[model samples]
Target: MEIIARRIATEFPKTNQAVGVNIVSLVNALAGQVRIGLLIFLGVVTIVLLIACTNVANLMLARYAARQKEMALRTALGAGRLRLMQQLLAESTLVALAGGAIGLLLASWGTQVLVALLAKNFQIPRIENTHADGWVLGFTLALSLATGIIFGVVPALAAASPDLNQSLREASRTAIAGPGGWRLRNTLVVAETALALVLLAGAGLLLKGLLVMRTTAPGFGTENVLTVDFSLPRRLATLPGTPSMNTAIVMTDRVRFFDALLDRARSVPGVRSAALVADLPLGGGQDSLGFQILGRQPPPPR
Candidate 1:
């Protein structure tokens, strides 16, 4: 491809030194910044998930601390350490699954709201078709189970091996937790706070960027403007004195068709004007066509 580009550039001898070709993946060319933005949002979502998990872990720790006497009593009554851990993990898994169900429901409703909101502002492809399908359900289920086990492990381990004598001797329900338990809880709270701050900072930056974009003008009047997109048929039927393979004739027909379409649009009631363009302003994507400068000889035909 580079060699071909160099050969093509040589045809424009005066501009050969200035001309260069860059190869970009089609996905990158089409999705561009939108893809980057989605990735950033995904990272933010992951951070938020971590914050939520940290908070839940702290709560689980507190719950286990409160139940230290029960755990010790169970252990004294022939309950193995594995049994106690399993019980705690079961409770955590149940909580996580419940939360996941609720989140899934909210996400379903929220997706509709988001699609409607973004449709008016941005031109994201196939956004309207967004839905929680089988893959989404599978992912949610996996995430719920993983989150339950991962976040539950620390508190479960801390609670499963309680001091049998001290916990049983302490008659008060408000007995202080062990240093290990306190340390773990404090660590979780600190982590939760830090993650929250990071999320806030990221959100603030994104909001500021969005506000700046909204305020910035795109060198065109946008009010009262409407855009319609259409495509011409790729294959035309062969007719008398007309070659279906002629590219120039096909483009001419397409141009005339657009002109007529615009004329009809202008004639409609309450219509002030209409015009045609290859791409709309602030459309987030563009199509490029080949053209030569005036007074320059055209390149040889392939």
Candidate 2:
């Protein structure tokens, strides 16, 4: 980028301007405008994932409690503790893997839809070709396994070491959860709720920022606005088969064309106004040129 900037600087006829060269990372250049919003979204999604894992763990605990009698009976029938735990863990993993499969399907479609929407909103050059690929598949598989282990461990431990005597004795007395289980579940719920509230607060702040941006003045009137694109003919623009047009010649022609077009445009009934600009504001960027004050030291690069 710095080299390109220097090359463009050399193209200028004026020697009065001071030019500087700089380079920026492509990813940073592309994502800079929405970096904050993207970060907020990522944080919120991470919190949501944590909340989900906690909720799922709580559900697994509930399932373990409900099957207390069955687990105790299995223990009585000479089931190994390791075997019992493995069976419970396997069930939890199975559920997670199924969910992961469904999520992969959703992501495959969502990537295309998201890219299309981004292309419609922004002028990003390569926005519509994203898809769930190998890295995404690997991430999904790893996340599913990790989620299963995180949420299933406690329940598996509880099921594996069921107090054969205590569980069997109290199995018929009530269907309610034990005090310890309730305590654990309550802790997880509290944590989930706290994280959820944090996510909500982040979302609210992001929305507020967007609203402020929308309301802020953009330094130009947009009401009842009409815009059009203009281009010169092949000969005027200097095609390879045609003689090259000098800069002065091209500008003179371009100005004449716009003047004629503007007159015609204004003549149209109900047309308010017509104008032209080399580049639009809040558009990508204007071409840059070097400049120096006539009687001062060169200013540093911005």
Candidate 3:
């Protein structure tokens, strides 16, 4: 960034505004003022992933415990520790991969809806349809594999312990979880619960904000009120005497045209209370200003 800034300064020495490059993600451009909400989504996703990993690990532990007898029998039959570990890890990885496949389908549908919402809210014109491309698929696969390895490592190692006497004794009856296993399970459960609560709170806050935005009045009645858009051509904005577009007479001609339009609208059958509006509530509007503040100087755009 420093090098770029220095180069920019050297190249555009005479520029009045700051000469620099703006570095930002596509999300910033699409989200605009609500860009921070992307961070909220990120936080929620991270927590959700953490919860999933914890749940997977806990379930794997229970599954491995239930299979202690079979594992002991295999050990007694001269099964190698590495082979047992590999087997357990493979099963966990497959489960994770299956879940990832389902998640990918959901993500594809979600991406479409997400893009539509962004386009509508941001008023982006002619946006391309969203789809899960090869990159997204690859990322999901990598994430699933990594998650499986991370979540399955401890349980796989515990189940692969060489000592079979304890497992064999416990296999005769119900298996009891060791202290370390209990601690890991309990800690994961607690952390998952905490993160879930945080996500819930954030969701509630966002929901409340949306409700507030929806309920707020837009300073206009929409019921039975229709807006018609039509452009006033140069001829329409020119008076009968004017030959060309004159700034001084344009306003007069425009007002005359609007009055004629309103009259025509009111003359239509069943039409009442005709009005013209330059801007509508909760819709796009444009305003141009040429002025300077009395005591404050506005900062230049960078």
Candidate 4:
């Protein structure tokens, strides 16, 4: 990006103006004005994934606690701690893979719904072309494996080192989780709660902002207003083997076209007025023309 910016600056230097360039991913470029909002949503999704992993870790801890005696018996017989941890991690990986599969399916459907809802509101180029492919599948597989290994570690470690004497006692149905186990579980719960609360707070703020915007006035009556946008072709239409019209004639034709269009629109019933503007009010873009005052030096750029 820096290289591109430097090249643009060197090639397109302007007096009192900086010429720069920004490099973005195709997805970010397509998102355009809503790119920041999309990034915030991506962060929220990451937090949700972390909370899910924490919850899964807590569940694994509980499961291990229930089967403490079984693990102790296996250890007493001949099972190695490394072997036990491997078995637990394998189980967690399988579970994660299954969940990831389900999530992928739902995500495909959700993408279609999201594109349909937002297409009219935003200028997202080629949004409909978005779909799950090999890359998405590969990412899902990698993420699932990583999540499984990370969340499964503490529970697997705790379960692999059970108190043999306590677990072997006939009266003890469930093995007691030591301070470390308690701390790990508590910490996961706390982290999960914190993430959830943060998500809720962000959602509340977004909803409140929307409500405020809904109530706010735009200082103009928007009713019965119909705006249309179009572009003029660079070259005027010409018969085959005929020369194209010059710039002056082309500009004259464009003016006449607009005059005819406005005249036709005004002729329609219930049409109170018609006017032309370079850009619509409250449009997402602005058009500007630079000018200098006569007999006055232009101010320096800030």
Candidate 5:
């Protein structure tokens, strides 16, 4: 009928407008959530990197102390300070490069597991979009180089100093008792401890926040609720005005199928009411839009 067709045209446009608004809202929400998740991930990675740097620094310091005799002999044979420094720097650079290569492989595998865990625990939709792309690789490479320089420079300078004779003698007597060496080592240890404390505190705060949110007021009871997901095949997703002759038949069949399903579910023992919903409480994939009350007086400004 002409009337039915006209009514459908109007209703279909409104329905499509609503769906578009919902999709845009969903996308924006998902983007925000993913951004926050990435930030948290970067923070964790940075903390791990700092710990690795501290460990590498400690290892290099120990090696520097043990190689004091070699350094002393080189200096005694008239090796220039600049040459010694270059050699130490080169050695440190080589070690750093090797570590960086190993770290890249580790990070590649770790990133996959990290993404999988995030998807599973947080219900992040379209998680396959997350990957260790070129940017991630570049960032990891830069981080590796920076870490190497930070942890290597101090030990290299100490090892390549012109006054190696006193350091060698002290190394032979007792390395730990050296005046500035103990101070430097203690300072590194304190820094590592502080970083660890900060990371732990952040984790504790996140857990406490989750606990508070979970315990806060949830309006509805969910004791006997059941949920289901409905999806349409791509081939069946023709828009209402499309030139698909079978669209009406397909839509009618789909509606009837859902009606039958609900009827069967309701007929089952212990079933109360059966209703369909676009989203469920605590479901992660849903989003909401903001609205302002109209014709209401504004509150006093603070």
Candidate 6:
């Protein structure tokens, strides 16, 4: 009777070992997927920020044109050109700082909505911990400052220049005499339009790629199908025993739980045949095993 009991114990452990490994692997895969998704989302946000900076720069340039006469009068007075430039730069910085403050408030609210949306779509673990951290705020400030400088410098210099007096006088004359000012404004418009077109083309390509991916065949019948995952605590995963008794216990519980769930599902009316699988089809990871092919050997003396 002791021999029979021992054999039964050994067989039970062997049966349960495979189930535990599958559960742990699935959990790890989900964690990796969540990390990747977060990175992609951040990348998209950075691109949108660049486009916004370009638009803001164009608006500042327009304002600089309108204020050219005032800047010229200031220059004609005791105000040094460098001092005017500094004042214009300071104004741009103030505008950027105000925008950044508003953006921070919006981002705080947006992040909560984003987390809730992700949770509805994916089974992410511990999503409450995801929030905008110090690095994000620091980056936003740096980006805003840099954008202010990039768009402010050229317009400020032009406005404060001595030659701008003649340009402003010509602009105040008949439209035919405003050739130089008109040309400058047209050039700025062309540049902005070209950049916008390039961005639009890139966005179009990305949208097309996403549409293609969505329409591609999944190669599986997903009608009325659902998936479940199980995981063991890290501390209980490893134990000192021959053939790992801890692994056996975890795997047995997972397999039995899934088996009972499947049985209950199948007992419902209009249900079809149920099959147990060790892994999901078309899942995120590769399942590979070392093997020797029948009647074929490796290359000789390579």
Candidates' C-alpha lDDT: 0.84, 0.79, 0.79, 0.84, 0.73, 0.69
Clashes of each: 0, 1, 0, 0, 0, 0
Give me the candidate number with maximum lDDT: 4
lDDT of 5 at 124: 68
- Candidate 4 residues 177-232, lDDT tens each? 67877888899899999999999999999999999988889889888988877666
Tens digit per residue, CA lDDT, model 1, 125-207: 77788888888888999999999999999989998988888899996553336677678878998999999999999889888
- The residue-level lDDT of candidate 2 at 243 comes to 50
Q: Give the least accurate 10-residue stretch of model 1, judged by summed lDDT.
A: 235-244
Q: TM-score rank, highest first?
A: 2, 1, 5, 4, 6, 3
Clash list (residue pairs), candidate 2: 18-291
Best by TM-score: 2
Error of 4 at 133 (Å): 1.7
Q: Where does candidate 5 stray beyond 4 Å?
A: 1-30, 113-126, 167-173, 234-236, 245-248, 264-273, 282-302
Return the lDDT, model 4, position 257. 84
Cα lDDT of model 5 by residue, 8-119, tens digit = 6567764333232223466766577777877997898789778778877777777877777777778888887788777877777777778877877887888689888977
Candidate 3 residue lDDT tens string, 1-302:
76778787777765623656677777666656464655667788888999889888988887887887788879899998899999999999999999999999999998899888877666553455557999989999999999998899888987777347787766543353777667767877898898889889888998999999889887767678877877788566455556566766677777888899899999988887899877766564666445878899976644
For each candidate in turn, the TM-score is 0.74, 0.75, 0.65, 0.73, 0.73, 0.66
Assess candidate 1 and give its TM-score to the true structure: 0.74
Give candidate 5's root-mean-square deviation (CA, Å): 8.3
Clash list (residue pairs), candidate 6: none
For candidate 3, the lDDT comes to: 0.79
What root-mean-square deviation over C-alphas does model 1 reach?
Answer: 5.4
